[model samples]
Target: MKNFNIRSLMIFILFFSLKISAQNSYINQYKTIATELSQEFGIPTVVILSIAYMETGGGTSSACKVLNNHFGMTGRNNVNSSRFKNFTDSKASYRAFCEWVSKRKFYEKLKGSQDHNDWFVAIASSGYSTKPVEWKQKLNLVMKKIGL
Candidate 1:
């Protein structure tokens, strides 16, 4: 029993550490770009980062790796013949995301809102995705986890 407990504790610690690392890794990697875009485009930094984190699973998703599509965006795509735009890099993906936001009816509202949830709600209200309600919920959860 004692030996089993020790192994269990060790495994738990390892798993907890990896989870924390993945969480921080995503923020550390994209926080700069997200902040820059937020300042330039008026979108909330937290909203941008949370969306990327949720959509890409901290940049570990297969779509992110193979298609450079961190936002699950689908349009003008030529990368894999799946009708989704395959970006050349993470920066390109991020830029396209910003463009999509800028063109939405909610863009101005999002730009003016300081609340992360408001930003997310605006995105959903604008029909950003097919399942806006579920999408907003996920965004809210990610925003909460990220503390923004």
Candidate 2:
């Protein structure tokens, strides 16, 4: 029993540490862009980062890598019929994501909302995703995982 308990503890610690490391790596990579966007757009930094993390699959998805679309945005760079917008770089992708939000009139009401909950509602109600409740729940979980 003692040996079994020790092994279980070790495994638990290993998984816990890995999860923390992965979360930290994600923050290190994307926090800057999220912070900048938050400051510019009045959206909470945590909200932006959480949403991006959920959408882009921790910034490792092919959609984000190849299309530069962190927000899963669909549409051409200039053509409406295009399926997704592609950017030259991640920075452009971030900018485009912010721009897309800014263009929405409903987003104007979201400006200056400090509460992450409100941001979640704004995102869902704005038709940002087909599964609004699930989307909000996932984003909230990401926020918690990131220590936001």
TM-score of each: 0.91, 0.82
Candidate 1: clashing pairs of residues: none
**lDDT of each residue in 66-97, candidate 1, tens digit only:** 89888988777665667566898888898889
Candidate 2 lDDT over residue span 89-121, tens digit each: 777777777777777776788887888888787
Whole-model Cα lDDT of every candidate shown, in order: 0.83, 0.80
Q: Whose lDDT is greatest here?
A: 1
